[model samples]
Target: MNFPLILFILLVITGSIWLLDIIFWKKKREPNENEPWWIEYPKSFFPIILIVFSLRSFVIEPFKIPSGSMIPTLLVGDFILVNKYVYGIRLPVINKKIYDMDKPKRGDVLVFRFPEDSSIDYIKRIVGLPGDVITYHDKQLIINGEVIRMEYEGDYKYIESGLGYIYSDRYSEYLNDESHSIIINQDIRGVQFSNVRQFQFRDNCKYRRTGFTCEVPAGNYFTLGDNRDSSSDSRYWGFVPEENIVGKAFMIWWNFGDLGRIGLSIK
Candidate 1:
């Protein structure tokens, strides 16, 4: 559901009624009697709706991690706060940027609306920027013909609630100056690149048996989940347009399952 759109509608309704009552209906009602239900309710809710709408629309917004695609960095059930204005100021509902700000850097975790289905939101790490060539082979990431530094960490284990434990090799990948951990399961093989859906800029990418190589188009970005082996990301889909960006996820505010995860900074 589009919560922002709903909030915006409520804000408009309440704000209008409150304003109309102040300008025209305030003196029409007797001071002794209760105000009309419509005006009273709207007046009561107008300030609240306006405040919430302003904050969520232009400042920060909260989101929950529903999948383990981010694994060690962001676990399932982690409630995160995304900085909306860090990238740019965009209008709510119809997200159109009206201000310019910093572009996404490599290794930054980003929240974006899925290109194929804008209603669906996805979170992933920025791996490739526009005009860069990204290649993945033998579970290693190569950008612009240079192999990105990857230092083996250790075995990473994930516990599924109903299922048993899953294990993968963990590595700290260095992109630009920032570093983040990623997990790749050798037992889990990737699908043939031919099986991927035809997405925008498909012609720019070349897929093979081992991995794929792509030149990120202008104003677009290539993203991947930290859980490399299990994620269905830009490698399977396509580059995310700048306009699809929601915000940069900064911190984990809550995790019901693991209290220790609360207030952890998201890299």
Candidate 2:
């Protein structure tokens, strides 16, 4: 559901009624009789809705991780806080940026509207920036003809609810001077290209059995999940436009599944 849109509507309705009461009905009501239900409820909720709306729209917003695509960095059920104004001030609901701010750096975890479906929000790490040439082949990342450095971190064990356990090779990848861990299943063959979606700048990408190469367009970014082999990211869809960005996720405020993850900083 579109929670922000719904909140905005509520804010407007409640705020309007509150204002009308102040201007037309505040002193007219008799002390013995109760105020009209509509005025009473709206007046009671207006301040609260205003405060929540302001905070969520301009300061920070909370989100829950629904998948393990981020694995070690962000687990399923992790509740994260995204810094809204760090990217720029944007209008609520429509999410149009009205101020300039820092651009996303490589290795930053970001939440953005899915290009194919704006209603769906997706989170991933920034891997390639505008004008960058990115390639992934045989589980290795190549940017602008230079292979990114990776340090083997041994094997990562993943526990699935239905499946017993899964093991994948874990490596600490260095990109743009930042380091982050990623898991890749060597047993999985090259990325599948059959279900590739046609996206903006689709012609800039070349897919093959080994992997894919993409030349990120201006004002667009290439993203990938830390769970390399299992993620449906830029390799399958396409580059993310700057305008679709929601915010940079910075902290894990809560994780019902893993209490230790609470208060952890997101890289």
Candidate 3:
């Protein structure tokens, strides 16, 4: 979550409630016409409760898909909700896990803090799990020393998704530990196999051109995007630490220009 937006919302809600109480609900016996210290005190908690419920229940929470990284799966303006407790219930802001829910599967779309900058949130798929060796050479996924069968029909065309764009290809991978549909575009190159250098976990990753290999750290996991070629993810920013995980995105609640986009599960 963005700090500025969180702080601004907190201020707005707290300030609104406090102002209302002062002007309309002030105790008649109060001696001071000037603001009372006690009223301001409780006003502070309005934002606190809001922040708590939002962070705790929702986990990763809802964020505008800012870029096309998860395109075809998530759009730029698609308002999607992430269930914070899907993977596990974690405290908001600090992001401490309290209870276990489920482990990340190969095909689930997820949101996590950027390993490079924990302040920034990035979305990607669980292409590789802890102890899994993943290779993406020539646009094919190799896991644990075997190619995970990808059929290529040559170039795929994609429409623009929000602030970013989407390329389409028919891909099928695993979810819930089973094979499913995934999208990839051969054009997505550049940062696909390279891990970001300037952050934690540099010792855990290795690089190559035919493909790169990284050992998913014990407490960390690797992620990719269903919309390949368009996402800046763990492949570039490094692995998502256990603490940096937000939640699992389940559905598209709303989308602009495409009313039909509502209620689509991530594939």
Candidate 4:
């Protein structure tokens, strides 16, 4: 629950105590007197906690993948590191950018707060930027009237925790300058309109028997999961707002079940 906020609270508490001891408490105590437990503990922890909080808030942060939504790129047990300052340095807890930096690029894997539920975080690959027209018809991705290149890789299969083995067709999809693997379940025929929710800019999207098309609104992004049919992403919910962005995921630092994944760069 709200790790950043909790860290911030601890930072304030410890920092205040450390400063108070330095300015008032320490000076008032006799030179040879030992410090009280409260002062000693907080003073000792303040520096260490400050270093951790600073690194986590503005440098890089660790996250563990918990779902199959980003299956091919990030597994359920994968522990990834998100670069916090790549898109810009945002304030801790509030998540408001105070400095400007590079904008999010298409094909970049990103972590962001779910629009419908701010408390929850989700990861997906960026497909469309602001002002882009994204269309998904018959499992093909079209952006701005041009079809994105998708080269067939081969058949792919994976085990879902409670569902046993699932199979799909895998392809290397090229978006912008990057190419990443994506899976499509041929069994799922078309976009199910019933699953698309009436989100804020629902009027901008049109659903059909084949699929759907949407013009990405200003300051928002369209994303899709690598595991196409298994994901509940922008197609079913809505675009990710600029403010909801967390950071760009860059590497997999740990994977208990698959040690080979450690130190692998995230595509």
Provide C-alpha RMSD values for all models, in order.
1.3, 1.3, 5.1, 0.9
lDDT of 3 at 24: 82
User: What is the C-alpha lDDT profile of model 4 across 1-267, one tens digit per residue?
Assistant: 999898889889999998998899999999999999998998898888899999998999999999998978888999999999999999999999999899999999999999999999999999999999999999999999999999999999999886788999999999876789999889986576778898989998998899999999999999999999889899999999999999999999999999999999999
Query: If ranked by TM-score, best first, what sequence of candidates would result?
Result: 4, 1, 2, 3
TM-score pick, better of 2 and 3: 2
Q: Write the per-residue lDDT of candidate 1 for residues 109-206, one digit (tens) a residue.
A: 99999999999999999999999999998788999999999899999899766598998999999998778889989886554455489999899998
Position 113, candidate 1: lDDT: 97
Residue 224, candidate 1: C-alpha displacement in angstroms = 0.4
Which segments of candidate 1 are over 4 A away from where they belong?
190-195
lDDT per residue, candidate 2, 1-267, as tens digits?
Answer: 999998999999998998888797887888786888988998899899989999998999999998888987888889999999998999999999999888889888999999989999999999999999999898899999999999999989897555777789989999877788898888886576776888889999998878889999999999999988778899889999999999999999998778988899997
lDDT (tens digit, per residue) of candidate 3 on 1-267: 566457556656777867788678776536766556666665867767667656644554666788766755676788888877888776555778888888887777777877667788777888778787777776677777877765554445566633454446766564445665556765656354433555467666666665577777777788877666666666676777778877787888888869999888766
**Candidate 3, 99: how far from true, in Å?**
2.6
Rank candidates, lDDT, best first: 4, 1, 2, 3
In candidate 2, stretches whose alpha carbon ends up further than 4 angstroms from where it belongs are 31-33
| All candidates: TM-score | 0.97, 0.96, 0.75, 0.98
* Lowest lDDT block of 10, candidate 1: 187-196
Poorest lDDT segment (10 consecutive residues) of candidate 3: 190-199
Cα lDDT of all candidates, in order? 0.91, 0.90, 0.70, 0.93
Q: Which candidate achieves the best lDDT against the true structure?
A: 4
